[model samples]
Target: MPATFIRRIASPKKAVTGLAVAAATAGMALTAAPAHAATTSSAADAKAIAKQMIPDSAQYNAFSKIVQHESGWDVDATNPSSGAYGLVQALPGSKMASAGSDWKTNAKTQIEWGLNYMNDRYGSPAGAWDFWQANGWY
Candidate 1:
């Protein structure tokens, strides 16, 4: 007699079950469900959304300039030092909640809040941009 070997293959369901058992034995919980793909917006998308929201060319350009400097049009942009967040870099981020609860992820919400802030504080986006240009913030 020389030697003999046999191999067995488990089905997908059994293999998954075995993996779950092994993970549980290692003190890990397999409570997470299968992940689904989520849609994400890009900086360009944010700009487009802003264009649609702000129809005035000068106002839109001014708003765009501020956002470009503040967040580079990133919806989830954050200032690590100031803790400012979102497209407009709302300090504390929670300030944008008055615009909408989805302020963190929705470009429209951030833009709406930013626009309102500019209108209320500086009279217009162009005015805000002027102030920002001189003071480096608005």
Candidate 2:
């Protein structure tokens, strides 16, 4: 396998200095709510978006762990060296374009794309989790 693939398998959660940040500008539109409430971070938003997709607690837990390790729940988390992007660290990130056009801004898009990848590549989230545990990545 190529070194980038090996590195992804060995350290899939690699972090970079220039992570894209979700703008909180939308919160500015909330006239009644506190600015802080409107300022929900992408990490929290990603977790909420993920739970909506997984729904089941057991599956969500496993998925959550993998995503946490891979991204610290940051939808914008990226691997500078490998160029993997988003919550589950999809390499090239553009591959997620299959899931939706909003892949860059919407955590739901990334989550759905990631779930599809785990399903297609490893049979299921549990299977991906197992592979990640054994190999240090998924």
Candidate 3:
């Protein structure tokens, strides 16, 4: 007979606490707004904006896939677990403010920020999509 080894995982509370400690140590405060907070547009409107912003069909599709998985095109989407917010799920949602002041309620601003992030980090939306597909994130 073969014996199996068991692995243990940290509880969600412990994991979140550890993350909060790390963030605090780095001088960053983690915060998230309620998902229902002021939303200026619907998913359909955001999708339309994304299509216009990303004119290339292939690139747009790739970007769309990532957004669908991350926030389902919600302009004010918030990840209760990680505090990621907006259409791109920017870890500190405030990061999107670099794109525009309307980051919180504007789909266009979020998309712009997301596009820049994809371009800067992975070369293109398609590249980001490839990474997201392999890692379940981007």
Candidate 4:
């Protein structure tokens, strides 16, 4: 052979290291980005939307109080023993699925499910709260 030239490529270890560095940099950027707030509405908003379902002001207040006591207005709240989850803490947790897919993370769905539950089971928020007070459930 008149002339021969050989060039060694970077090893697998070096390629892996390069990939790791790139991945880490991407992860850091993602973490540094501001978190997006969960799409949600307040209990007041929920009440306003469903006001026709709960016409009585006193009943609305009681229901609002009970939910506040249970979750402090957190739609993601969960009770371990009862598997009650979301604003209204539907037993089995999956009951809110009827409203929408975001039941676990969306406040509007939780509120809608809660309002429906109260109307169907207890006739009103106050009625549901009354049962909750007496039995620690509704």
Candidate 5:
């Protein structure tokens, strides 16, 4: 018989381990995407809820103006010096607990609390805007 030589091939376990790592990394990436999407969608949902609650178009516009200046409609915004937080930047932030337990993470809760604050403090969003325009803070 002619000389025969057999070379060992790479280990199958190593190939499987590499594929497992790749699959785990891809799964983690997918998880990250949902969290990002949820944050964006929550902002949209909060804005929609705010619009729906503010039956008057002028009031909604006024509310939008205030929110734009305060936190740019970001529910997670926080003022480092004052500890104010959320879309309306409620000082102490804990005051939003009255709206809901999810106030820290839920934009809708923040919007609801913000609207109530505007209505209670300034009599209405337009009133708040007027104050904000004149004083730079509402």
Candidate 6:
């Protein structure tokens, strides 16, 4: 099997990244309510976006763990070595173009691609979570 396919199939991190890409393709818009007129995103902000992309309640906890481990919820998180970027860490960061051109900084695109990947390969978040448990990298 191809490494990319295996990577997409096994990794929760990759699954979340796939969800972001799907969100971008679907043109998911994120709105912020200001606590004091300065728009800010909290953990809830990430969770809200995540819930929209991933509707399965069982998948939520597993997905959140991967996001926290990979990027700590920072939308602009980047890996210099592989050039992965965004909340879910898109490798080369540009493969997200499969979803949209805004893949670089748009959290939606990354999440979309990730969710699509998880659904396609493992069938559900629980399946992805099981794979993750067996493989540390996932």
Top candidate when judged by lDDT against the true structure = 3
The 10-residue segment of model 4 with minimum total lDDT is 1-10
Better of 4 and 5 by TM-score: 5
Cα-based lDDT at residue 48, candidate 4 = 59
lDDT of 4 by residue, 19-117 (tens): 556667657322346554476556655555445545678876877777788776767678877778877778877978898877777776777788888
* TM-score leader: 1
Candidate 5 lDDT score relative to the true structure: 0.81
Candidate 6 lDDT by residue in tens digits, 1-138: 225443344688677676666656668744555433222145567668888877777787777777777678776688878777766676766766787666655566667776666667788656766787788544
Which residue runs of candidate 2 sit more than 4 Å off their true CA positions?
Answer: 1-40
Residue 108's lDDT within candidate 5 is 73
What lDDT score belongs to each candidate, Candidate 1 first?
0.87, 0.76, 0.88, 0.71, 0.81, 0.67
Mind giving the per-residue lDDT tens digits that candidate 1 earns over 62-112?
999999999999888999899999888999899999998778888998999
Clash pairs, candidate 1, are none
Against the hidden reference, what TM-scores do the models get? 0.73, 0.68, 0.71, 0.60, 0.68, 0.61
Write the candidate numbers in order of decreasing lDDT.
3, 1, 5, 2, 4, 6
Query: In candidate 6, residue 12 scores what lDDT?
Result: 85
lDDT of 5 by residue, 88-114 (tens): 999889899899877887777778898
Kindly list the per-residue Cα lDDT of model 2 for residues 66-86, writing each as its tens digit: 998998888778998899998
- Give the alpha carbon lDDT tens digit for every residue of 11-124 in model 3: 987766766776787788989755543445689889888999999999999999999999988877899999999899999999999998779898888999999999999999
Name the Cα RMSD for model 5.
10.2
Residue 46 lDDT (model 6): 65
TM-score of candidate 3 to 2 decimals: 0.71
TM-score of 5: 0.68
Report model 1's TM-score to 2 decimal places.
0.73
Q: How much does each candidate deviate from the true structure in C-alpha RMSD?
A: 6.4, 19.0, 16.0, 11.3, 10.2, 21.1
Regions of model 1 farther than 4 Å from truth: 1-40
Candidate 5 segments whose C-alpha is farther than 4 A from its true place: 1-42
